[model samples]
Target chain A: MNGDDRWDDDARAAYQLPIEGEEQARDRAILRLRRESAKRRTGMGAWWVDPDGLRMRPALAAVCVLAVLVIGAWSGAGWMASRGVRAPRPSIATLPSGSTAVTFVFRAPGATRVSLVGDFNGWDPEATPLARATTGEIWIAQVPLEHGLHAYAFVIDGRDWAPDPSAPLAPVATFGRRNSLLVVGEDQAL
Target chain B: MRRLLALALASSLLAPGRASGDESEEARLRARLKPELATPVIEVVRSAAAQGLPTAPLVARALEGASRQAGDEAILEAVRGYAAGLAAARRALGSTARAAELDAGAGALMAGVPEDSLASLKRARPSGSLVIPLVVLSDFVARGVPVANASNAVLAATRAGAADPALLRMRERIDERILRGEAPTGASREGLRELLMKTPGTPKERGSREPRERRQP
Candidate 1:
């Protein structure tokens, strides 16, 4: 209120700001840093680690890999087994001469009736009606013969001449057809 | 002891002949063998004949040498037995019913196997309507189908049309002719292949810049 020069230095110093506590300023600066860090941490949400979580993640991944490998191996093995294993194809059975039983098996699903036709009965289809076996699909017959190699075919449905499904096939003169060849060894029975 | 000494004396006397190799001895044995060997030879002949195979030459050769050889009765008899077995086999298989039955069954039996495998099988098991079944199977396998499918397809085709039976008959005839040493002509072969291929009706013409025969893709 006096506005005089007597306390000019004191007035100027009073008008100027005083230095604050260093500890307090440091505390304020630290508080601001912590707030910023909290905001950043909140932005990157918490990924808390459970007691067994670390072990479980790797264990699950390993189990998944193992399962895939096992499935793949099983599939591969099954495929190989299916491809490798096969049935025994039908073939001629030989027996000693004058011994009773000769059998033939031929597969012809489309044919209604199948008969054996060859030289023994002068190639008569009607004379040799082959019996069907337990499988019912195959045309089988047992007829006694003297002992020799014979040429033959399946007379299907009384009309069509078809070769045996299990016979040794030969390319014949007729397009799309084959003949069966059989050899009966003497004294070498089935 | 006396018999043993006699046998020694005989062997010593024959030692000079023993100096010869197997071929000479075989020949000498052939020359001195007897008729007792006929049984086996007949057996062999029967077996071969059963499949309508000609074992005559084999039997004749065996007998020719063995019968002349008064050397070993066993040799002659062995040869005859071989012939007999072959003959018996042939006779057994020669029956029309048996052969037909064998052939049809074989088509199915050889399914899913390769030709080489079947060939091995043939070697191992020398009986039945084998060669023909194997041939069909082999052809099918070569054409990319499993043996089962090939066999089934063939059976189906064989059952299919007006010409099916005729074709089957022709196959038998052709086989017989071949066995008798006749050479098959191209047209006949083509016809047969066509039948086997079962390409219903005439082969269709593929669109042609090149003729179908010349086209390779």
Candidate 2:
């Protein structure tokens, strides 16, 4: 038999045997109870009254709180970073000095009506429709330009965007189709 | 409801400003078309010829076309005036005419002098043929001349041809203002025409004055 097996058997036998010395057994039980009670009291004292124990406990608590705060801040920053960049708001465009007039010309063979919209005229689509020229092209009603650069575009037949062919081209497109930028000088170039 | 009310109020306020802008533009156009301001194409062409310049007949053709298109007598006259002046200046210098000379001629024509009179004045004094004198006159009239000229140097071009029929219309208007005794110093022939246009169908007494701008050399 293995040593552990023999030892287990012996323990079982010993447990099963009745105590021949009742006075000795009673003394051992009382001693065991007193030792257990002393240990519990010492544990409670360490929690409530021991200075070193209190200091160590508070330090551990602080470490845990700091870890939680760091995690929360990092998570919040990550969320903000993932949101991407916001677009710029459009400003009401004003003409610079010397600009007096602007002419818009659109070449759309299929279009029946063409209208211009921009920060000027409050983006009103129905305001002024372009008249058809002899070549089936569309031209604007004589628009008096303000001084400065203006961004505008043509809306053809209420659906499509058509840029002006005759006007100077603009590369910037922060809004819709590339806008027509017109620079009105201080003096009219008639 | 509140937003709609705010929008309505805002639009109502904006409407007056827009209307004012339109009225001003119309007024400016009306001023441009006054009958007394009109200068004939033939006088302009003949004036340039006198200056040893040649102008194509294309300008005349354009004037005639514009006249036909414009039923308003005043507008027709102004377009014809501009065309005539351009032709006369072009004839004087041909394609080789300097930009400064062209500008001066245009400014004078805009001021309402007959082209023939302008040519005769230029011939009367050798100084008038030069660009500097015409530029100065343009400046005195508050018009831009592409060339450089000191304030003292420019002189008026000549006027001698069939008396401008348009001048008679302008004369009545000028006499009205003169009777009322408005300051006559800065008044232009074109300005007088504009006044007459405003008082259309109102016959007034006629009077004449010496040409306000004469070459002094």
Candidate 3:
């Protein structure tokens, strides 16, 4: 009932980490470490690692399911990666200068990798990779652009510089391949 | 062995050029076409040649129609119209223009681009092949941009010395606008404003002011 010092410094320190509270805290800490170690040794998080829990038929079924899941995830990732990303702005926004955005699409169904390389991105294939659309054969990417003309081409499977079929030709044949033109923010009458 | 290998390589390289054989393109068109379509398609081809216009395009147009299994009457009309447009293009582009330019110009004409605008584009460049400009112009019209705006916008750029690359860039930007569901006219206007900023003396009217011709932005 002596409220002035609230329980004594020794009692307050008792609840603190144990260098101050010693034997009891030390014993509890050892018990927690042992429990964690035993749990990890049993691999309870992965039931298959515990042999008694595994039955022959269920084990085979689980393995098959795991394989299916992995293959499905891999294929699904390949499909999603192929679709790249298209910014869905249903309206043309008057964005600030240096804030224009455009999407590029290339329809190469069999290609494993597609990248956008252009003057804007220093013609680096690694700079902009396209992802495949899950439902379609097209590969696509949306890139922000500054207001000006930029020339580009799609590198299919890291080679085969293919110009966009819907884009205008840059007409300059760099390395015997024509580049495509992307005019970001301006319009020419024609 | 080396001589034999070199001769084989030479012949293989030459193979595609001779794929059509020694016959004229129209003759090939006739051979490949149905009986009803052959005569009129040939007439269009021959008439285009008589006018000093490229006949291959007309033949190709007919053959393309045939390949698509179009009706004979429709094929004939398309061939005739394509040939007439080629003639118009040749007239506007002058006798020195190339076959590719003529073909693309015809496409522009078919897409409702005015003949005089083609001529104006020719006058703007006045020296190089106009194939790309014509193609881009056709593309603009195909994308549903108003013909006059397309013509003027392209002409404005061409007048400012925009080449194939610049023209294509302009087109891609406008196309992005169209893809955003902007009306072709609105798309053209917004895109033109962007282009005008790059071109010197393009009357940029902010707020409610109307765009005055040839004024500095």
Candidate 4:
């Protein structure tokens, strides 16, 4: 009984030492692999190529903000155009020499063309063509006018005569149609 | 030969200097008008200019006719009528009247307002520009206000010390009232009443409110 028991114990001990050494070697190899993987993740290889690495640099942030604003403005203008809203009131800026810069805005949604025909422009429809705005319904023309009374009308598509709905009607209907009246006072908007 | 030379010298002496503005205006007329129609129209404009009246209205009238596809005769008549109106306006508004006043005055006259009303307006607003009062007067007439009623309303407003803004406001109110289905005359009368009430220093008593002539400067 003593001999058999002693031999079994010695054999078990001899096997346990190699097993423990193998496990230690395996653990060290595993740790080396983990450290190499971590180095690759944080290294220059990932820094330049990874999108997350760009995280809000000033140039990129500014570009993003500008892109958002441009998209917003474009959409807003398109919405305004679809609604057929009237353009804003005519703007008048007085020059240093007391001359007036009169911005004439007309809303003609479906018209292909619009022109300003007035006494100041010799009543020639082609003399002052109004430009269509991005809003699509409005046509605008700027005129430098002297300080006096001006009689004007809008010619639409070169055939239809339209008076300014915003201005006073002229007292006389010389051509069997009433024109609009504008009186430019000193430093005054139409 | 001596007689011919003398006649040529006399002709040269008598010819008026053609201003660059006049040339440009003539060129515009020619360019805008047909060949046969241009000559008579130019003569009318020149005559009006020679008389110290504003020729722009005359030229504008001709061009308006052309733009409207009016007949040549109609165009000529329009220009001549406008020129006559300008002359009448000058006489009524006096030589001191500015180009704007004359233009407005001409428009008022063409709208069936009596020349005397223009004269009265000049007297009422002697120091101020009469453009607004005249334009408002013309607008009232155009809106179907009887010429006399429009004249009286504007005259009263002017004599009540209403400035251009006040007069414009009165016009806007009248227009709104007319748009709301009120009779033009009643609208004008009520509009005038509202203005008089709002006017500073205007007597509240119906009897105390003097006639326009009595209040004139």
Candidate 5:
């Protein structure tokens, strides 16, 4: 805009590159461009190496992206290799030593389905399905009951309830149904 | 808003014959309560049951209320509050979460753990049942462990493929350390960090150090 301002701007630009200073880089780029221009009369100078030409080559950009992909892939492979995934075991429920092995038995004459529902399985109806005897009217499942008081009952035909006949006398109001009470770790577990 | 949306979703998704089963359950529940206390408590259970919220905690609330000799209105309000809490817990823990997980997770929420942190813990252990972890986590916080620190400890153990037994062991160790006069925050922070780092593939978890992660302070 003004002569003094132009001079100040140029001076400021001189110190843009602190290590080598902008002036030195500018001088080197100009020298290289002039040498190339002199060697060939008109159009021999390449775009990448000229004083005001493109600062980075398309090749460099490709290389950078490739390097990033390579590093990312390498790390991802290592992560996959290190992750240990084990299948959920169907039996031998393990939690604490004090936990008791409780055998839940129920008799349903015409029922096609029976599951042992309780506090131990988060009351998940599907988590602990009972195994029915081939020729009998009984269903049974042995589950590891955690150490503490648990309320449970048998769910029959999905929505129907059939209380365990052998459950203790104490009946509790649970899920609007009577749940059998069993305290694990009593008598040091069974 | 969340409650209304959930209720609408659940009601719309219900099978035609569901109400009969629900009606019987409700009737049985009412039969169990005193006449003066039956209406409100049953209403709360019906609302929660309609939304597919776990209904056991509601009944347990009534039983607890009766044990405490609380007013009928108080029992209803308590059931309603717990139902809402369970809904929030299920939302955070995901739809596939088991009833026990929801029960324990609700306890965690009541103990002051944030819903998003519970979500993170669930996401971290995509396969394990989080019920025991959540129960132990809530217990730790109740016993004076800072909420964040307790959450972090649970998350770490779950990520390490620790199950109910391992979690119980970790809880015992942490509680013992706390009883020895060490601060809960410090004990959980360092103890969980070390345990997680030793978990085969989880060594990389040591460095994230996200300030928002449920941990000390």
Candidate 6:
């Protein structure tokens, strides 16, 4: 046995040597690699569309719920606008105790004067006057009113009594003239 | 010493701080109205205030009359009548009724709704605010629905647990129907039917009650 022949024999023995479960170990390694590859593919791409069905992490679920709520609210607001329903402006602000500052707006073009008269101001036309906007016919006034129901009307030019077109009409036409009704607080009747 | 005590009493009575709400309200009336008119109106308001009824509405009524250029007699009559209405409303709505509720109830009473109907309404919604229901009832009457029909509709709706927004929506729908040429009574009935149908937990049969035709106003 020369050195070449001995080397050849040692190589063959090394290649053929198997202690136990060699085939099973090789098969398990192959299976693990396949699973790892599958996991890598699924985890990196759109896991939402996984054939196994929908599954989501906690963060993802929260985001999806938030998106749904925002979209629903947006669509509802659009629907309301389309129906000519104007959301009441958040114009009422807390002022001094027992009173809230409420903004009243009316449009009167070519008017010399406009005044707000209601139970809050003793129905005196001179109590709270609305200022005219420079660009348009809009007249605006912020009046501090006690929390309750009030009957009011606009005095255009200080003589013509006009009920607020946006507000509910009072039931009785006192003095044969209709007045508008306003509810100042959370318990608004109309 | 007697003279000094008399002077002290006079000064105290004349002090601005000593002027009570009733006196100030009288001052406002006197300022805005003729002295002759203010005296009687103030009496009515003071009497009402003493009876635990709201006086603001009475004073407001008188002032509104004056602002509208109404006659002194008309103003006096309006104030007296309003005070009477407030008393009646307080009776019907119970003593615990809020001021806004009383005001709305008085309007409903003045709109031809019977006192018993007002009582029935308070009975129907014992815990909730009756302002919207009472206002709606008055609105219906003002729009030409017979008082009986209006009262029945509102009572039924309130008893059925219709919220304020629902009642207001019903009012808008009825107003639209009236503007479209439907009789007020018919519009109100149909509006109530629609409301009952939509209100949660409302019985099915309650919305299908027989309708009575009322004379068109």
Winning candidate number (DockQ): 4
- lDDT, residue B30, candidate 1: 38
TM-score of the first chain in candidate 5 relative to the native first chain:
0.46
Using lDDT, rank the candidates from best to worst. 4, 6, 3, 5, 1, 2
What lDDT score is found at residue A64 in candidate 2? 91
Model 6 bad stretches (over 4 Å):
A1-88, B1-19, B211-217
Ranking of models by DockQ = 4, 6, 3, 1, 5, 2
Q: List the residue pairs that clash in candidate 5.
A: A95-B165, A122-B100
Candidate 3 vs candidate 5, DockQ winner: 3
Q: In model 2, what is the error at residue B213, expressed in angstroms? A: 53
Q: Which tens-of-lDDT digit does each residue in B76-144 have in candidate 6? A: 998998899999999999999999989988888887788988898888789988888887787788778
For each candidate, what TM-score against the reference? Answer: 0.27, 0.23, 0.51, 0.71, 0.48, 0.71
Please write out the lDDT profile of model 6 over residues A1-190, one tens digit for every residue.
Answer: 8999999999999988985898899999999999976775677555566665456799999999999999999787555433322123467676669677777777676788999898888888999998886635667788777778888888999999887665666778879887877676745424
- Tell me how large the interface RMSD of candidate 4 is: 1.4
Candidate 3's TM-score? 0.51
lDDT comparing candidate 3 with the true structure:
0.66
The number of the candidate with the highest lDDT is 4
What's the CA error at residue B73 for candidate 1, in Å? 51
Interface RMSD of each: 14.6, 18.5, 13.1, 1.4, 10.6, 1.4
C-alpha RMSD values across all candidates = 22.1, 28.5, 17.8, 13.5, 24.5, 10.5
lDDT (Cα, tens digit) per residue for candidate 5, span A49-153 = 656554568899899999999999978744532321111133334566756566665667778988876656645567799888663566768887665545566
Q: Which candidate do you rate higher for TM-score, 1 or 4?
A: 4
Quote the lDDT for A112 in model 6. 85
Model 3 off-target regions past 4 Å?
A: A1-190, B1-22, B199-217
Any runs in candidate 4 off by more than 4 Å, and if so which?
A1-90, B1-18, B206-217
